[model samples]
Each structure stands twice: as C-alpha cells, then as structure tokens.
Target chain A: MNPTLGMYRPRNTPMHQAPAWFKAVLLVVIAAVFVLFTDPITSVGLMAACVLLLISTGPPLKATAQGLLGIVIIAALSGGFHVWRGEIDRAIDLAADLVGLVALALAVTSSTPMEHMLDLVSRILRPLRRVIPPETMGLMFAITVRAVPEVARMMSESRSAAKARGLDRSFRAVLIPTTTRTVGFALDLGQALHARGIAEEGDNPAPYRRARRVKH
Target chain B: MIEFLDAEFTAPDSGARILEPTTLTLDERRISIIGANGSGKSTLARMINGLATPTSGSVRVDGMDTVKQGAKVRRVVGFLFTEPSSQLIMPTAIEDITLSLRRSIKDRTEREAAAMQILGDIGLADKADVSVNALSGGQRQMLALAGVLAITPRIIVADEPTTLLDLRWRAHVGALLRSLPLQVIEITHDLEAAARAQRTIVVDHGAVVFDGDPAEAVEYYRALMLDRAVGEPAT
Candidate 1:
C-alpha cells in the first residue's frame, strides 16, 4: 500500500515555517471573505494570488494540477449548471470564488504537516476541553487525516487483488474486506493508545491550556 | 523471560476453543513458535504482549501480569505483526517511529532526533521523510521494526513477519530480527527460521506439543504434519 499523500512535502519555505493554526485561520478567513464579497475581478485577483503562492511552494506544477483536478471538475459542473439556468455572470463569479477558496485551502494542506495541523486544531478546540478533551480530538483528527491515504491505498490494493483474482466485478468481495479491515485498524489503534498510556484518564490536562502556554 | 500458566482461549463468537489449556516458559534470547494455519499459534504468541488475553489462566513477562497490568506489560513487550502496513499508523516513516516515542520523549525536537537515530540504525535514515506507502514490502517491514524498536521494549514478538516477503528479503529481515539485543519471540511457518532460533516450540491445535531444542521441535512439527496428512484421505 502506497501511504504517501504528497500533502506533507518537506520544504523550508516561509509558509512552512508559519504556525499551522495561523495558516488555517488565515485560509478560513480568506474563504469567508471570498464567499461574502462578490466582484468577479476581486475573486480572480484572489485566485491568482493563491495560484502564485502555490507555485512558490516548489511542488511540481503537474503534481499541483493533478491534485486540483476535483476542484476543477466541480467548478466546471457548477458553471455549466449556472449557464443552463441563464445566470452566466453569476456562474462565472461563483466559479472564480470556488476556485479561490479551493486554492487557499490546498495551500494550507500542502504546506502543513498533518501533526501540526492536528495540533493547531487541538489548540483551537482547547476551550471545549471540559466537553470533548483536546487530546482526544487531536488524536481523532490526526487519525482521520492519516487514515485517508491509508484507506485509499488499501482500497486500491483490494481492487487490484480482486481484479487479479478475476473477481473485480464483485463489489461485496471488495467492500466487505475493506470495511472490515478499516474497522479492525481503528480498534487496533484504540488498543495501541491504551497500551501506550496516551489514553489514560487524568493523564493530560485540557489541550487549550497547553496551547496557550506554548504560545506565551 | 515469558511464561504462560494454564492458558486457554476460546473464540467468543463461535464458542469453539482455539488454544487448549497449556503452559510453557521461554528464556531463550531467540525463540520461534511454529504452527500451521488456524492452529492457534498466533494467538498464543500474542498472549506474550497481552495482545490476545487468554480466556482462562495468566501470562507473565518477567513476572508482570498480562491481564492485570496489560499496559505496563506492553511497555516492555514490543509486537510486530505480519503486515507492516497494519503496524504503521503514521503517514511517513520517520513520523511513524516518532509517534512511538511520544511517551518516551516529551520534547518534540528530541523525539524527532531520536526517531531519526533509530531510522539510521535500521538503515531507513534515508527514507525517514518518505511517505510510508511508497516503500516496498521489505522496507515497510523494516520501518515497522524501527517503530517498535523506538519504544525500546524489552521483548519483541513478531507474528509471521516474513510471510509476505520474498526469499532474499526474508533472510534480510530474519537476520535483522535475530541481531537485536532484546529477547525475540517469532511466530512463523518458516522451518529454516525455526531452526535458527535458540529454542523452538511447536504448537498444534493451541497447545505446546513440542518444546525443546530447535532441531527436535522441527522434527516433531514435520512428523505432526505428516501424521495429519496421512490421517486425512486424499481430497
């Protein structure tokens, strides 16, 4: 199974040095601004700036383009729907806004490691420590992010194995094992955490307080 | 050293017994547990680290109770599964090892440094930052070993670690596991590996049928397989 998502590319760029939470907050704010303010020129400018920032990250242009394929497809489909409804200008503006938002989000993901992003998320969610425990949330986020590429790899392997066995057409054969294994993995991880003393009750204080302390 | 006292395991769902009540002690630096598929051998090996708790009886690692103190037991008992992908929980090789060190090393920078040191020791220093998914089967297995080793457990239990590897890679991994300083308990179907271990235990239907010298254990297992084949008429 190929586990590499190419999202955590190691680089010494300034963007990589910025605290992950700051970048995440900035990306969210930019997205909200793009959605709230609606001039096509403004959207295009923001989109262009995001593209330039992406280019400066030094990931291959082809790789970047390949990663953005889903966004591109969504933009095209939404634009088509808008034109079909006879709102051509609105469609173009929405497409630009969507592309800008996607680009901004991609930049954050590309530059930030999953651990840092989870830490940042945990830090932001620290105030809810009484309700949901920050470390648990951090671990959940990290596991979810980490499991995405792993699950994808397992599914691809299962598909190839099924195809090789001439059972590629059977969705049950592929899906059953994949789902079973993913659940098994989650259980194993929970066990591992318990074994490692990381999940013990009253072991760590609320995550937000820790983050605040780190900030100072 | 590891010891099992009157251990028995029954499948919770089927109510079918896998491992019959059995007891044995292992003090060898390198030991192998050999058995056929569905023979309850892996379950027996897992009991060493509290991975599989016995339905009855107790398992002890150097006197630590497997059931009552499972977390404490696991801290000193490192486990390696047959599939490295199953053991590796992180995205990158270095990160995977570092995750294991989260408890051992509190400082993030020191944790990363120590993980790199372990990677270098395991010959995976060059692939530290590489995504674990891109590694070959053998490389991934080595990375898994590195992750377990990073925790610096006293005893290592590996279940069919080389089953998925080719011959050369199998030998390479076998040699690597053998070279470690920790007490090693490997569960495998590989006779050659069994022969190399300081002691061998041949398990059948969940009980230790033969426990002694590696050569005698091999002979006992071979004969047992032959007896089974003879007992069954041609399909």
Candidate 2:
C-alpha cells in the first residue's frame, strides 16, 4: 500500500461502491456542516466520525497517517499562530475542523476508484463539449493524476544528483534538472497521446460497435 | 504494408539529416531494426506511425499517406516507447486500457469489460486496480502492451520496448511480442532478439546500411559497432 495522499485504495465497502457524484455531494454537505458549526466539541466529534469512516475502509493505518502528515503540519502551524495570540479555544476549533475535512476527503478518495472520477469528469464536461472535448479533458485529468508520482520521482533523482556533487543545498541545482526532466517527460507524453490516436477525428464516432476484436 | 518512398528526415533546427533518402517496402510479419545511438533508427520507426514526418519524401501504411492521414494511420499502427511510464497515462492498469478503448467502445460498461478482458489476457487481471506506479518495470511494460493491444492495431511499431526490462522479463516480453498475429517492427539494441526476426535492417549515420537475412544483418551490425569502437570516422 503506497502512502501517497488521495490515492485510491482497493476495498469492499459501501463507500467504495457509491457513485462519484453522490460521494462528491456528500462531501460538500459535510464540509458545509463543519464550517457552519464552529464549536470545538462539534468539530472534534465530526473529526472522530471521519476517522471512523476512514478506518472502516480498511486502509493501512500507518499509510493513512503518513498521507495526512501534510495536513497535520498545516494544522499545527495554524494552531500555533492562534495560541500565540492567546485564543486557545479558537485554535482547537480551527484545527479540529481542518482535520475533519481532510479525513473526510481522504475517506472519499481512498474508496472511489479513479475510473469513476474520470467518468464523472467526462459527464460534467459534456455540456461544454462545443468549446472543449469532454473526452480530451477527462484524459487530461487522468494524465495529471498519473504525472504526480513521475514528477516526484524526478525530483528525488534531481536531489540525489545534486547531493552527489555537494550542491544539495542549492535550489538552482535541483530546480534546473527537475524542470528540464519534466519538460522532456511532457514531450514524451505528447508523442504517446498522438500515437494512441486520442482526440483525433480519424476513428468513426459511432456510439457502439457490434464487433469487439480479440487482443492481438 | 508500410512503404517508405524515398523517405528522409532532417532536424528542423539544425537542418541536419536524421534519415537519408530511403525507398523500402515492409510487409514481413516480424521486422527488426538495429543501430547505434543517434543512428536514426528511431526516426525510421517513428515515421511508420507518423510520429516523425519526413521532410521530403512520404511514408505510407496500407496506401494511406502518413502526413495526410496520420490519425487513420495511427489507428492502424500502435507504437510502444522504451519507457513504459511515459505511455501509461491512466492511474491504474484497467483505466489505461479503458482509455485506449475509448474511441472504439462507447458504452462505459462494455468498455470496462473489454478492458478487463484485455488485462486478463495479458496476465494482469489481479493487478487491474493496482496503481501504475506500484507495478514492477516488467509489469508496467506489460500494461503498456495491453493498452496498445486494446486498440487492435494491425501493425505494432516498438522503439526499444524491452530495453528497460531485466533479462528474464526481456525474454518474456520478447516471446510475447513474437506471438502476436500483427506485423511487428521493432527497434532494438538486443542482437539476439533481432536475430529472431523474419527480416533485419541495419541503420547507420542516417542511412539503411544493410537489409537482408536476420543473422547476416546482425553480423553486419556487430562489425559496424566494432569499426566505430576502433575510432573509425563516419563515411
């Protein structure tokens, strides 16, 4: 199980089977509730509910904790700021609300498969098909999701290369290679897209083909 | 059939020849191309699918001009890159396959079912939901092939598809590629794999230096490499 944030985890649960639109609406409603009710007790209770929901999905506890580390750092910083201004109760409320929202988001993403999200994006963009192709946009979103780990890997490689030359502390050394590699990767991806014949008008636009050819 | 009618490529910026004037007809079931680094072998393979257009002459697949009918030619020809990560655009194996079938299969359920069937055929059924990043290099290459096969391409043009795989995986993928019914034009540094092809082509310094029997072509390529290693200047 990778500890990357917002990555889908395979599971068998109601949340996993739920449709993308439904989960999105539920997320918005829950988020609204959290914002509307600012009391520390209510926020903490909501956060607990979110955590339980996440646990029910059966993801590894350690991975989940690691995935939430970024949010934790931000929450701590905000809380520290409030505490320095002598608003202890406000800090607790704010931190709890932030944690609850992120946990709920993680629960939704971990349960929902990327296909569902892509389908939902296609449906949402269908209305704007005249200006932008829905299929192309959906594919773009998928590629963006795929590029996350690749960019991270490239960044790690750049850091190592810099360290080898004793330039690890220099931002320019890391930034230059990472940026160049990312651009090259993008060029490769563009060629792949072209080779795949995506967003091309050559293929027939038939809604359904009666024949499904076997794999070559 | 793929035809290169005096096809040639030149660097747009430097105006240097990448592939010299070449006239060739490719109809073999398996064709292997071998060359040194920057020898324009990749440029030749890319032209088959219109990824790299010739500056002067024309390349055609089944009589369809690559420049004018590139998209249609791409449907007939599927390309595989050396690095599978660049080609696998979707987050998961099944999703990537489904994306490949998007134009062919319209119904979502049917597309997904077809994707699953392809995954199963490729021995990746259990890993369908697994993230692409988590898969081993060989598995990712297999997934990329699955995506290419989902489109049912008549011709598969692979540019060093197995160069990144380990020895065992290279053999596995090589055997799998050989088993395909479609015409396969592969660019390889692996002489043994090239020797297994029906025909072999040796490219050097923007020209087809040799094209004939597989074993003979391999010998020619080896000799060419030796000459270069001994500090021979370009002809």
**Top-lDDT structure, candidate number:** 2
Instruction: Give the winner by TM-score.
Output: 2
* lDDT (Cα, tens digit) per residue for candidate 1, span B1-235: 7888998888878989999998888898999999889998999987888777888988999898887767678888888888777677777888778778876787777988998899998788999877777888999999988878877899988899999999888998999999999999999999999999999988888777888899999999999999989999977
Model 1, A1-216: lDDT tens digits are: 223423677898877888887887788888887887777777778888887777666665665687677677898899899999998877877888887776777677778776676567667777776667676777777677678877776688778888999997999778987888788877776655544434344335655334422110
- RMSD of candidate 1 to true structure, Å: 5.0
Model 1 misplaced stretches (Cα beyond 4 Å): A1-6, A38-40, A125-127, A161-181, A184-216, B233-235
* DockQ for every prediction shown: 0.28, 0.44
TM-score of chain B of each: 0.97, 0.97
Clashing pairs for model 2 are: none
Model 2: per-residue Cα lDDT over A132-207, one tens digit each: 5666677777778788778988888899999999997999999999999999999999999889887666331333
TM-score of each: 0.88, 0.90
Worst 10 residues of 2 chain A by lDDT: A207-216
